[model samples]
Target: MADEITVTVVDDHPAMLVGIEQWYAAAPEPLRVAASGATSKTAWLPPGDAADVVVFDLQLAGQTTPAFGELRRLVDAGRNVIVYTMRDDEQTALTCLDLGAVTFLTKTEGADHLVSATLAAARDRPYTPPALAGALSANTSSDRPKLSIREEEVLVEWFQSESRDLVAQRLNLSPKTVTTYLDRVRLKYANAGRPARSKAALVARAIQDGLISVDDL
Candidate 1:
């Protein structure tokens, strides 16, 4: 059997810490909960005794934003980090990626998804949630046409609907207007080389941009 994976969880919430510990405790393979930290003040063990995966909350009580430097320290020392946070803002997500987090999972996600992300992180693979993955890929290019507030609104309403007519009614726009907005969205994506073909794809892109919540959809 492969060796048991070691994990460290860092979050201010005691319940969350215990919950995560319990999940690892019940895994089929030997899954060790190496350590838990509620704050950055705690001493992080060296790589030898350190965890293979670290699940951290991007925003702690005292921290307004994610401490990318601290996260970078762990990565540089050969540890992988999975950001488990409630903040689903697009800039925050992009910053976390730029700072080298292996994966970003929202607290709103189910426990199973968290466990899967944890395991994937242990394997040195990125575990971006499908909703967020679509979002991130959509915003890759700087040259993509900027979406106006009205256009964005139209796009959101369109994707959230089961039918184009429904979307048009909700947005107080005609079907032709909705179609025009969608066409523009498609052209923008195509020009940026990140075209989204379907409503699901569009939803994903919206999530990545932090325009919509994964739970909202």
Candidate 2:
């Protein structure tokens, strides 16, 4: 379908591939696993199933080709990517970001986070899982910032609202004000070195931080 966000997963472990397929089996509309394989060469995106994003694992069967090298090529080919791997080191995460990965999510972050990361990537956004987000700031000893009460109210309302204007109206704020607050949230994340960089990414962060649930989307 035109609206379906196609995905290609590259992981050597058979069970992980199965697990992701099962998780997305119930994902909301507009997301589908188009194809998968154990290595980049074997991974294929069929003519009808051109992938929008690739969920790649760092370690593959051969291990000769660095996953980052594959990532750069896929991204250069105009495909978004969410790095799904067991390694969660800040250095590797930073390298992935530098290599143009849309997001870097450790497998331990849970299936929901992986799904959310793909959604964010498809939307041209960056999603940093909570732990990874914090890792970005570890070098500077920076603590994650708290959103103001108004910011929290706006975010929750926006997530639950049918429209931004509706959220603004319900919050007794102007549409511009709502936008400003959301921008602030984005800026805060960026300033902390955990840049969310897009609306959908912020939504993912909201879910990660317990500010909202998947149902809220």
Candidate 3:
């Protein structure tokens, strides 16, 4: 299907993999689990590389704790990853978002949230699941990206506007200048170790820094 959202699922549990595949198969929209594996190598190395979105389980079978290394590798490679795990805490969710995951979802969020998040990730669109929104709201850390006034203006306007052109028109600046400001904003976030590669990720960053609220969207 032309509009089909292709997914690469990576989970350690065989039963969980089966369940996820079933969820994708029965999704309301055109969705496909193009590939799945029990580990990073088996799941994302070959066939999974071409998938539109990667549904990843943070805690794999072998190692203890969440696998931030693998997650970092994927994000650094410019892959849109959704960290699906059983852990449902504000810190963990915030950590994943800061590391550049497209979004974070707990396994308990179920099929509806999972499918919606997958679709949003595949299309490079914004999606904030309830858990993530809660996390963003609960976050009180002082850590933030140090953006210039112009950069913040452009960033906030871009978030409110549908497109960069609209932002430029509203600000009375050239489209190229608007793009430059946004690029600088992303760079500042990246330099602060809070990568914002997607609009959704940037939105998450803005929320974390208290520059915007969930209601602002």
Instruction: Name the TM-score of candidate 1.
Output: 0.60
lDDT of 1: 0.62
Best by TM-score: 3
Q: Which pairs clash inside model 2?
A: none
lDDT of 1 by residue, 170-208 (tens): 878897677566544543443343221222333455566
Give lDDT tens digits, candidate 2, residues 1-217.
Answer: 6778878888889999899988887777567777888877544447323777788998787676457887777766656677888886777776666566677788777877788778767866445455455344443333545667786676566545525689778888898677666545543543344232333454565566555567733
User: Relative to the true structure, how large is the alpha-carbon lDDT of every model?
Assistant: 0.62, 0.66, 0.74
lDDT by residue (tens digit), candidate 3, 95-163 = 887888877888877888799889868865445555665565455678755556676666667645536
Estimated TM-score for each candidate: 0.60, 0.63, 0.69
**What lDDT would candidate 3 get against the real structure?**
0.74
Kindly state the number of residue pairs that clash in model 1.
1
